[model samples]
Target: MENPKKDSKKINDLEQNYKNQENTTLTTNQGVKINDTNNSLKAGERGSTLLEDFLLREKITSFDHERIPERIVHARGSAAHGVFELYESIEQYSKAGIFTDVNRKTPVFVRFSTVAGSKGSTDLARDVRGFAVKFYTEEGTWDLVGNNMPIFFIQDAMKFPDLVHSVKPEPNKEIPQAASAHDTFYDFVSRTTETLHNQIWLMSDRAIPRSFRMMEGFGIHTFRLINDKGESHFVKFHWKPKLGVHSVTWDEAVKISGADSDFHRRDLWDAIEAGHYPEWELGIQIVPQEDEFKFDFDLLDPTKLIPEEMVPVKIIGKMTLNRNPENFFAETEQVAFLPGHIVPGIDFTNDPLLQGRLFSYRDTQLSRLGGPNFHQIPINRPIAPANNNQRDGMMQMDIVKGQTAYFPNSLGGGCPHLAKIAEGAFDSYEERIDAKKIRTRSESFNDHFSQPALFYRSLSQYEQEHVAEAYTFELGKCMHSEIQERMLWLIAQIDEDLANKVAKGLGLEVPKSIEQPINQAIGADADIQKQQPPKKKIYLDKAPTLSQANTKFDSIATRQVAVLVAKGFSMKNFKKMTDVLEQEGAVIKLIAPHGGKVICDENMEHKVDAAIMTTESVLFDALYIPGGKKAVESLKKESKFIKFINETFKHCKAIAVDNEGEDLINESFVKDYKDDKAVFINKTPEDFVKAMAKHRNWDRRTIVKNIPV
Candidate 1:
């Protein structure tokens, strides 16, 4: 209808505009072409990161300021007030009061979060979970900011911004929120081989944890523990949950997101409110400085993890989260954590990622919480007194009264003077250094394929199947065939069978070779051979601790059991099963056909927690349906009740039924699965409790995958 010439001209102008802005070469904000944006400048290949590294500063600074008012990563979070009690003093390794004082019950504030989501994103996203703990010690504040996974995607901190930008929603549309199953993410991951180790971990069940209380936490970076004699030992911190590491299937995770977006947040708060405090034992893998190079992997490589089989974890102390925050904003939202917040007995390592994080976290807080004075907030305040000469910032909550505000002042009588080493003054470890400054990672960090291979090999049979299925789902979501093919090749490098399975699921073939080399994460002028990962190696047959199959399953504390009932239910059967469950600390919720109370066969009124239509099977850990002829008939009328039973069986969760309750199960997909080990019919209450404690009958996964529910 309009002018054809004008339309052609507009198209021509748009093409010209795009051409004007096109530049294949990567550059800084200042328009300086970068030869190497992959590595931070360091003293040597394995030495500490240098302060003069402008490239690292610019990239990290930009990433830190990218989001304001909310954290750039770990935006959606929940917090709790806790106490860390020392089981025994390890003064031989460290002098920090929290670590050495057996009697001190150090107060702590812990925050759990999902990394790739906004402040409002769903809790069940398949992403890394942040497990950050801040300990208020007598000497100073110590923060162990870590994740549920032991390793990260990249090695050097210089590439962090690029990694985040790729995994985040594409800039053009921002369509996929809090998800990594996309074209940009695969493109980056295929090129950057270092991400494969953590990438495989994401595909595992660990990404979708059952609860914050049940997942293990890792410091991710190697840190140093300083003794009173100034001896240093490389240490990796671990938090072993009392409830054992467990995860929901990808199916259950998806359904839980829809049924209850705040599932995890509510689980944590409700557990604490009901006096079922969550607990974790602090463990550390300590390696002497003399034995730093004893392993095949570099201690400073953030992308690599030391296998538990190599260095055994020594359980040290226990932490119990007994209280929830009163105000989300005043406490959970305002609390700040910094890796630099260490006491006298703790010191930093030369790990490049850790070095960069020391600067990035503080910088992020400045933009997020207004200014440097965020530490003055009540939740983040230290148990030890803080006195300093620097003053006057935005939101300066402290009032410094003095005749002089400078250090070593005669007028103030040197009131806030520094203390000596013997008087608990913090000091950096005296690790000797003699090396030329360079921009490259250690050769030890180049073996990217071995650990990922080891991880895949360590998983149980069913766990491996889940990994393959997860990869299929994620890669299938990508629009580019080239990206999918590249990822398939990388997966082959990890495990050939895994790659083949995922490839089949995607209706594609694993490429024999690709146009570009396997690793393109190196610099433009860097030696390609040096950066490329070598053929996969077998370090050990398997690391048994890496798999959840070996985790503890001794108790059923805080397990949620959904009880399906209606009017004229058997009160005797209900009380018999619930009594033992409550004694074992399991939470019992009644789901009925309606919201109001239902009268049992004994004419006793029982409160209904929710109507059957309001809750899903994914919300609870297990199911119990007591026998009652009228009640069974009522439940059979509601179609969702059949779905509820079918979905529970599909998830492999434990299900128990009494006389007439068996009739209800016969009407659903669970009828065919009645003989399942976790499915108890007229079984003893103790036997049912034992089945529930096993978490799920994972063997049933082979049959349940075909369930329509």
Candidate 2:
């Protein structure tokens, strides 16, 4: 009768305490002790060192070969280890044990990466982000390797090499490190008609996500879901963030790259360390197999998307990342994810890109991991035991003891026979494929402009303007005039207004008309041609959800807020405001003239997180300049401090000032000091806290002028 659950919790807590205390460190590879590590062994203190210095030689040699070659794409990445818990069973949809068990929890590892960057590139690069999740289920490991955008730039895998070559740094000069705004990329865009939809997304806010946790992920290609009854349905996978989608402005993103190259990685690590686990809801869009051709676009086309309005995403499960990797190289770097590494109950569709990826991933891993035996690595090994007649290769970790290596041998007694269908053995979906051998896109895959136009027309006015601005900025960097003109003409085809707006920004004239051409293939199905253009379906009257502006903006959790203070700052008001905001899950940092402790009027000193010279306004979400007669007076004389406040205001972020601090704003010639929704003066800490939760003030952009270029 005496609460058994409480007793069990107490025992578990005691065990955890003992585990926490069992930690030790500091030893060389040979278990040798070195007292001084400040400097390596040298001759006569500052002279050239000798080879006899074993410790110095060992340390330097190890450091030299520390890094491995990064991925060809998705080179810049961040990762976390977590577990996925099923909320309910969907046994009718599939026979996979993980999906059919309501109370089961499966271990998972997720990696988020930028597509075009090198390992040392900036996190805020305007590139597609890879969202790859690997699940260790009871049957085998399943990898859902996807990207933040639901669609891709190419329809077939054959064009992948060309697409990557154009987007990467130019072969001759490698001038840009992690940028797509180049002549080669633009040239490819003009020729590849199927890339139109993804090009629009690239120009949208989706390209520059504020953080990995705030972005949505998609499987990109169509897949099949077969239930126990052998019934198949085409499906698309989605991972919607619980905190909602958010993005930084182009100017801010550019500044942030210089200010902090690891901005997104730092955000994710800090959130998990602070106990703010990022969450995402798993959703799927289902289309009956018989009705696959009912849609205007072909299901096999990777460049097209099935609008959510036509086939709504059904939310089924949730994945939460609550832990960070213990070692960057051992866990995050060595982890290999393949689209073909799927378990039972999950099968592939006949999408050409997916088919090519199935072959490319395993082949690439052989060279990248140094051999075919990469699965023997601890990070890549399956949790479910692997048993087969397959033998040794480079880096082989296992030894099979059997007289006969071949299957169906009498010496081995025909052992290791195939398991029954009831067992969790993988079998491809039994959909019939009776078509003649061909290597061309279906006729239904012809239309590439309708969805791009729909996406352009659905955005909010501010978002639409940003897209236009992004297109102008990217095209402006191109040195070739013809490339720019060709891209502008393509944009005109998608939406004439968008083309004109971008042209105006670039100081060029919009083309009066653009040419359209009929299909002429160079592959196996060269005779294929459409008699009519693909019809556009009316998905929504206005798809507000497609825009990042319509996402959630209520939470200020993990948001960095700058509190400007100096000597003789108010301790009472500072503590009061920070306490409430901190309780509401905001991160507060004090910025002063120097990084040392600042003395308050109440005789309390507080440590400054950063000094004015080292910290910029672009690094924070909002600014709060607290009140103190002396503190405000000191800040008013400092140009850097004044510019910091002005720039924050210019960025349309929330700004709060106390009475004494408000006086300094009025004296400064930033703008009219009229207190509005953005500029809060003489407000209570509660009121200021509420205002900061809105993320940013979109209305302020309309009034501000002479904004930073």
Candidate 3:
């Protein structure tokens, strides 16, 4: 058995350097022992947290500014401490130690976040999710700053600020936080043809994921992986979740925001704490540099994706996030991720959006983390010894031994010299760049509709319906008729049926002509007519990999199952179902009519995880009910219990009932869902487990559309 603690020496050493207060008296920041943290030094017994109270002042003052400036985007985040291990060495593709060393366990800190939301925003927002990972590798730190989607909204770095500003809340009112369903966003999207590919995806089920563990992540740019021989391959990195891609419906997302605003953050933390650590297979599409222009779309374009059918992803390793952050601020908040943090073999490309990020991320960290010494922060520090001539800045923790802060100093015996190339010295791939110093756009990046069309065509009918519904809901939120009209026209360019469906929902006609300068995202002198998007091509028909309908449904592991019971519930049915599910690594919680404990038919007491009124169906992945006349009748009294069962049915999640549990179902919407495949009545525990592994029954998707719960 491999002991994770023994293998992760980097984390162990890092922890040793931390000021752990375990089994110690509470002390002030200046190391003086404190007595009372409960009450302040008040003038009277009931006075305010006084300014004269040094102890109280220290605590309050620290807390007043406890929060650093939250990220402008991806402010709401959930992070985990993990380790990445290679399955096999791909030394030919890249010589980075984290990629090539199969024996080494590289400690990693991964933060998952929503792109549009503020720090206090809801996790269920209909926006892009940021997937940023920091690998504290032997060579140095490497940050893979990416998103859940493979493509982005813009092609150039210059338009990034404009894109973020438009998608954010309206500048005047600051209304509708963490959402893109506004006039300004559609205004930007309607004009920029490059935004179509990612805009369509945002309208798909990928935007609002069921859990952080159940989504795929993409590098979103054409990065380079160089070998020791200095050979470069255009690579697109992928993080394929083992639990498979899954999501809640838009209706569910809206309700879940109210039900549990910390849905994703809680799900991730609970899963890891329960020993069901989430895992992802790291894969890369290694496209030869010479074959970059072989595809119809430009490789340098951030708005385009190289279809898996064209260049198959090569699975390299697996990353398991086994631990939650020890402290949210020390680890999750302060940890910085930059695209510029690369090793010898991994390098950047000319992807404009990526080039912008390489600069933006580094600059943002300096502001957010106080100074350039942010790298010295424990969470952001590299495992390897950082010996350099770069001296003191803000928050410089290291104590320099000698009077040598400059390079080429003979007094300090010319110490801290640069490492040789063989000793893992950092080096960029020497690619020749001889071009005119002119501000001109590449005509190759103009064809944007084809990949979006390809993405839409690839999804299953059920998935397609979700996309259409998402578009209808988003566009319905916009107040401007002109914005909606132009959006409808853009939708028409992607698919006529999709456009017509949205038009019908909006109660408007798809315009014959809306705007002539559709591709107006160019310089002043550029010919408007000549800059028109080229005809979209049908390349490889359908990339099935893009569809979540084709995701793996192999395991029900770590799924949240809510068990409903009250006084005198069946002990037999509860034990039989839970024993199997618990064996399969599912976390089962007992929700009763009241808090505290519930008495089973066997007179045995079981702890109640949540009362009927306290919890909602949106918080759970599935529902289980055990038989007992008293238990069923008790659960029947609460209206929320009925709503709970109805909401679960409407969401198409698996529901299992044993013996008298059918009685409870009879009182709710489950009476109408008798024939539903996922609604197993008096089914065996094994059968319920199998159904849950399928995630949800899609056949029920059409029928349960109108259930008002």
Candidate 4:
């Protein structure tokens, strides 16, 4: 019988081999040890005579050049390091090694960004969000570049530059820093027929996600998936938030932009650090090759979507962002995403937008990163060893030892041979292509109003009202009356009632009808009459999952709760509530009248995280006012504190009052206090805790008056 000890000994030997790799000391480029990074090298007695210091010079030079050119579109971004685990084998759908092995845990880096924003822009901008992920698999680095919206504004890649330029700040003025509420964007929307569907989404709540963790991600373009048997299937990728899709009100989002420009980044960092890891389930919507043209819209069109109602998503794996980036510049900023970066079993479709991205991403990185050898950067490098004949570009890190670096070289004995099919070399699907080069779109791609109408019809009554209000607000900002009228006409095409609502708010009459298409030659059919009438809304069966009201709010994890305190506050009650909140994973920030420290009635000194003057009610999820006799008196006199309580009540956020704190609320302008869902009475901490768990009180908006205008 074979001895079990022999197998254990072999495993031990491998472990020892891995351990034998010596750990190196942290040092500078010149091999000098780094004693203290907190303080830079300085002259004696801080005299500022450090020109001869090599350490300081090197460090300053590195810091100065740390930033590269940010993405032209998705300039503002945040990233995290995580691992993706496959729950079950998907070998039948794809030969991708990462999906074949259920036991494998692949290292992943995910970057979420706001498109059309500068590097310094606010995180709450109403724009398409970039949700790109790079998987460092053993086979290679596979990048899935996607967006929060499943569909795009244009169908072809050639029109991408035009679309981006239209949405970006106008070249001459650059007035709107990170917003799409402008004349130029509205003009583009009115002129481009294909943009209607995406414009509707942009005008909706989906554009203002509460947090990066609460948003869904989608690969906008259809792709090809291949199995081990060489069988191919058309597929679209999706990443569903485990917390469920949720969004902030437009008013809340705008206020958040002012209160905290780094709201999304802060949320992600705080959540991960506090161990409330953000998770998403990896899902795919698959369609057979034969059914590619079976849908109403062409499979190659990027502007169309195969609704979940039509083809349900099959969740296959899970990804948890358990770690934050060690350094922002090195990890988050330098990491690049290219759509062309795919491993075996994963291939691209002929979707024009995707095809263009495949070329544009790599080309942009070459210039932005300053060289073709940008992949050599530690953060961008693949975990798998790269061995190829391509060599010698700017900043080349690899040191090749062969005499010949080209293929079919006798000097190198024909080394670095092409990988075989069994060795996991990428192979494209055998799709037939026999079309003439033309600047025309398929007829099936022409009917853009149907899906937009469907989306508008799909929203709940409250959501529809919000969408109408959002359109009015955004259009009111535009100085051009014609642009607003044209947009109103477009909206009317989506829904007559929606246009009428927005027009009423704008104090302008809606146009009788938008311009009839001058050039209606679309799709293969090219019948103008066929495109005149939008399709009947088929998705009216309320998809409760599409609404933000259904999102997970049971857990208060990662929620920021502002606790009001002062000298004479009830120490026992405050401690009890604080302990329960902390245990429930809520972060408490002590806000006092003064900035520094506060002494409790029990003679305990607690430091204030932020003064009432520094933070706003909009910055936190909930507010808890602990009873202190003197504290209540001081808070009553402070208008900012009163504003905080009043604004929190108006916004429909949870507000809890204890002891004498109840008297302060009674004196405030919140008159219909008893009917407000946010205002909590009685002394029990349990009721307050339960109210806080509800996240927001939707009923408060009806009764509360004198809310922040």
TM-score top scorer: 1
In model 2, where do residues sit more than 4 Å from their true spots? 1-68, 513-539, 667-673
Error of 1 at 576 (Å): 0.8
lDDT per model, in order?
0.91, 0.78, 0.84, 0.78
lDDT of 1: 0.91
1 or 4: which has the higher lDDT?
A: 1
lDDT per residue, candidate 1, 1-709, as tens digits?
A: 4442347676578768887886857788999989888888888888889889888888899899988798888999999999999999888899888888899999999999999989989999999999999999999899999999999998888878888999888999986999999989998999888899999999999999999999999999999999999999989999999999999999999999999999999999999999999999999999999999888888888888889999999999999999999999999999998998899999999888899899999999999999889989898899899888889899899888878888888899987898999999988999789999888777778888999999999999999999999999999988767789989988998899999999999999999987545443355675545536558878799999999999988899999999999999999999999999999999999999999898999999988999988999999999999989999999999999999999999898999999999999999988887789999999998999999889999999888777897
Q: Of the candidates shown, which would achieve the greatest lDDT relative to the real structure?
A: 1
TM-score of every model versus the real structure:
0.96, 0.87, 0.89, 0.86
Clashes counted in candidate 4 amount to 4
> Model 1 misses residue 613 by how many Å?
0.9
Candidate 2 per-residue lDDT, tens place, 527-596, comes to 5443323344555566666877778877887778999999988787788888888987889999998888
Clashes of 2: 0
* Candidate 4, 517-551: lDDT as tens digits: 33232333334434345444454444455566666
CA RMSD per model (angstroms): 3.5, 18.6, 16.3, 19.0
Q: Model 4 compared with the native: what TM-score?
A: 0.86
